[model samples]
Target: MPAESEFTVTPYSVDGNVDYEQLLNQFGADKLTADQRKRFPDPTHPLVRREVFYAERNLDPFLAAANSGDDHALVTGRGPSGPMHIGHIFPFYFARYLQRAAGTTVYIPFSDDEKYLLKDQSIESISDHTRENLRDLLAVGFDPKRTRIVVDSADADVVYPVASALGKEITQATVDATYGDPENVGLSFYPAVQATHLLLPQLVEGRQPTLVPIAVDQDPHVRVCRDVAGKERHDVEKPGALLSKFLPSLDGPGKMSSSDDTPSILLSDDRETIREKIQTHAYSGGQTSVAKHREQGGNPDVDVAYLLLYYFFEKDDQRVQRLAQEYRDGSLLTGELKQLAAATIADFLEGHQQRREQLGPLHTELQPYRLTDEERRQALQTIGYPDDSLARQDSE
Candidate 1:
């Protein structure tokens, strides 16, 4: 953990090292208690069990729904500013896991409009990224019947009106405080769209619990949505959040982390590319030389290769422990550890890549996942819009 003074966690930016415990305090969210952890569908996910997903806000209801086999949902999103990466897609897999374990509906809102407003890019470029990202998302094999993929611009007939209603509750002061000064009004208004994303399932499915599993930096978005959900006129409950720590950057923990500009392992990385990137860039915690490393064992805690495996790539608990112990006891060299992580990552990517290739045309494959016409009308009507007129306009 980095010194408290050095780190900051906000909705839009995370700088320095994150103190997740302190973050729970500052964000006014609860840490995952043993009781709550037990409530998660049997076989708690590694992300939850290992505490990568560390804190939450009002998560009990969602857990209750999962345990009781009642209606519930998981809302994880994508900002298509660039290509999909390993760090970016794990949540979708986790959502799929929950869907299998608890039959939870998933709502994936792709924020192409937000990325276009924030990034220096043309609408054409943003649309291109959205299409590519959509392909990767489709390959995740979510249940099409239970999943709804909403693109902000593409689904504007539904998203825009709901956002317009929610926008009334958000003050400019709150926006500035949460996101700092917005570069433009689109950035200022994007939170309302986000609130719309978080609350849409309830509006459409009838006030069931909604869970947003996301990186903790994105908690502020949940908070804003929760706040909007609190309005008395709305028949919705505040959405819960399952917050996660940042997957470390290749450089190491608290030091270097993944970003758009940073060199990251993409979803489509070939075996050779995966090997080269991990071998060339993975930060090591072993001694300077072989003899020294044998004398002073490597520290898996600071080793990016070990962290990468432990974080998501390696699924077996015993295997990860063995690797850590081996590295710590001088039995595993930095090169060997890097190779192990690289191989694990390469295998995972190869599988995902194969799935990607196996997918059909993007639009046809995505058809089952897109929102239904009735769902759009329901969401609009729930948010105080009379869909009779709006539905006609949309159809026309």
Candidate 2:
């Protein structure tokens, strides 16, 4: 771990000991206050309740819309760079909770184009990953009527035109400042595309408060979109953000990454694989010797096994507290905690995998979730293409 103040966090990478509170200051986001939490529909998701999702910018309008049963939506996206992992699924599940609780419309965008530009991969490779990723996303069980999944390349009819309009508002200097200099022109243009993703819900459904729930590292993307929405030309409210800490990696405390030497628990891991991985690779907070651990109480705060449960797997608050206490006093052995987390995580994945298996052909299952022709037209029209504005003129 780097020194307390030595960390670096950006939309692309995170390193060292991240001071999350300091990040809020650096990013100009506020803490997710108690008053704001109170306004959420009953049975708030543990991600929010446990402060796993701990910060915000412009959250109230969305909350007001949620409470009053008015129009509201959430945009949570995926980058199909590789197979989905445990860390990759948090925001999707969190969004599902909001959808169930408040009837919130959900828009999921797969930035395959961004991944292609950023990674040394081909379009075919990205497409393969996109199809697999769509399966995992489908397992989360969002309502088809209220949810729309947009793939940047596949949906470019709407995405490209909308992004082109917003691109005029976002300068190269702004993109350079927010994300650093572009490695490629596609990346330079991606911030505008990202703004298109965030604002698309309102663009299609008419102006409504939209909330983007994402890890704190992604806040810059939201800030860029908010800046564009503030411009006079776009008829949209700035999307709000609900930011969260990086999910802890299996090896230790820093952000989880597939690039890390320690293998991540993929969404496809079976019960045995999950157990073996947890028992072998999970970082321990206990003493070197069982006797010493019993004598001197372990620190649950840094334990990967315990943190996984606290972060998502264990929903029963009292049980989690009890386990933490037991672990602190050495009543809960580190192996026992690992066993418990492996089982809990396996249970969650069991259902997810079952749903995935039950799903029909990928293209067929994905159909209902794709934007309808009318929706694509509405989105394009909102960005100034009325009835395919140019095509109509050309035909005449």
Candidate 3:
């Protein structure tokens, strides 16, 4: 493991090589136990079974609820700063897997407002990204009836009021400690909005277990929200967390960034573009020369191509192991490995792009997935803002 000083992780920034185990220790999250793994639905998602999603905070309740056919939910969100990238889609896909296997309710929130506050970009730019991101999210094939997509700016009718209520529960000190000193008041107040996202399912559907499947870097957000839920003033339990390691960027390990100097394999990338990006940019763990690589096997553990396949692109367990073994034993050359990953990723993108193409205009396709009026009312009422009062005020 790298020394503690070698890495830095936070909600807004991640630098250097991350030590996931160290992160779990630092974050006070428990590693998923052996029994916890078995408790997951059969044909477990690669993220879970393979230990990509490796740690948790109070996961048992969610699992118990899932097992007993009780209401349970998964909250995984996005910040639409730009077009969606391959790294951006993992949690949604994982949520979809659980939704399919165990009837899990999925709530996807797009924090467009937060992005606008963080980036030096106009509202129009953020809005454009939000539309594009929503299309990609819709293509993930979540069940419209079982899923709700909340865009912060678009759904403020429900989001803002609840966030205003919850905002009282979070201290500015807590926000400062969690996210560092905010550049703007909007960011300082954003934690309330984030907590609102985590607790929304329970607020609307009545209190049950909700799990936030998010990257480990974002654990502080969950911690802050969990603290708010712990307060007795709210009639809600602390939302649990399923924390995952950062998806490796093509250039090397560390969180994949849309604005990175190196290119990310975007969800919209075509076959040729994906192939070119992987070939040109993916960091290789093999020897400098082909002859040297053949003489001394490559290390797939650190190879970007192998890591991508292992992480998501290649799903077959036996095949993944075989490829790793070949690379380790000098039988698989670096070029050959990159080619295989490119093709597999290209194939995956083809399907995602096709679904994206099939989508109607953003608002029309996003309609069924929006919160129902009753849902909005229930959420507001639960958060201490009765809809009748708002209605009365509007009439007055």
Candidate 4:
């Protein structure tokens, strides 16, 4: 394993001494507070209560909107470049929970075009992942009326024009600095698409507080979008950001990492498969021998099994703490810890799979969540071309 002492977190890379608090300082985002968490609709999500999502940018407005029964929305996106995994679904679930709790509108944008531009894949290949990812997203069971799932390529009518408007505000220098040199123009222009994704709800329904929940490294995209919203004369509010730490992968403590050798646990894994993966691959912080482990105890901080539960799967805080205490004192074995974590994660997958299996044909189920023609027109018009603003004229 590479030393964790040195790390770098960019829009495209994350490694080494993450130091999330220092990240907050560097990114100019505020740490999430307990009181702010209480403002969530109800039954506060584990991600929030446990501080998995630990920082925010201008969240007071969103909190006020959620609590005051006013207009609010959330933007959580996925880049469809590969298969869906346990780590990819948390934000979608969080968005669903918020929508259910507060009646908040949710916008989920699948950046197929961006993935195509960045990856060594064809557009057709990216489309395949998009369809597969969309299925996983649809299974999250968001309200069709309140949730909008936009495949950027499919929604280009609105996405393109709006992105053009936002693109005007992003300079090549900014793109290079935020994401490094783009291999192509499409990649260079993706920041605008990202901005459009963040601001789409407002463009469609008029200005409202929008919170974008994402990993912290992705903050630069939100920052770029916020800058456009601030600089442009458009009638929009700067989108707020809700940032999270990377979920621990089966391999180790740092964000779920996958190398050529290690593979992530796909959402399609069966219970037995999940158990085998965790037991065989999960990193352990236990002592070398049984006697030594029992005498010296295990380290939960670096134990992938314990971190997995502490991160998301284990809901009962007290129970999680007990597992940690037992591990620390050598009462809990690494195998036992792995079994517990595997079971907890598999239980989550079981419920998710049940919902997924119950899904109807993708196109049919996705229809209600797609942007309406009127919405597309309004979004396009709001950015410019008031001629198509008929859909938004009354809403104005």
- C-alpha RMSD by candidate, in order: 2.0, 1.5, 1.7, 3.1
What are the Cα lDDT values of the candidates?
A: 0.88, 0.93, 0.91, 0.88
Tell me how candidate 2 scores on lDDT: 0.93
Q: Candidates' TM-scores?
A: 0.96, 0.98, 0.97, 0.95
Question: Is candidate 1 or 2 superior in lDDT?
Answer: 2
Pitting candidate 1 against candidate 4, the one with the higher TM-score is: 1
Candidate 3 Cα misplacement greater than 4 A, ranges: 1-4, 389-396
What would the per-residue lDDT of candidate 4 be over residues 1-22, giving only the tens digit for each residue?
Answer: 4465456888777867688888
Full ranking by lDDT = 2, 3, 4, 1
What lDDT tens digits, residue by residue, belong to model 1 across residues 1-396? 456667887766677666777777788988888888778887888888777888889999999889898899989999998788788989999999999999999999999999899888899999999999999999888999999999998999999999999999999998998888999999999999999999999999999999999988988999988889998989999999998888877776642334535578889889999899889887889989999899889999989899988888888889999999999889899999998899999998888888989999988999999999889889988988775965677999
- Model 2 lDDT per residue over 253-358, tens place: 7788987688999999999999999999999998898898898879999999999999998999999999999999998889899999999999999999999999
Q: Please give the TM-score that candidate 3 achieves against the real structure.
A: 0.97
Ranking by TM-score: 2, 3, 1, 4
User: Which residue pairs of candidate 3 clash?
Assistant: none
Model 1 misplaced stretches (Cα beyond 4 Å):
1-4, 254-261, 389-396
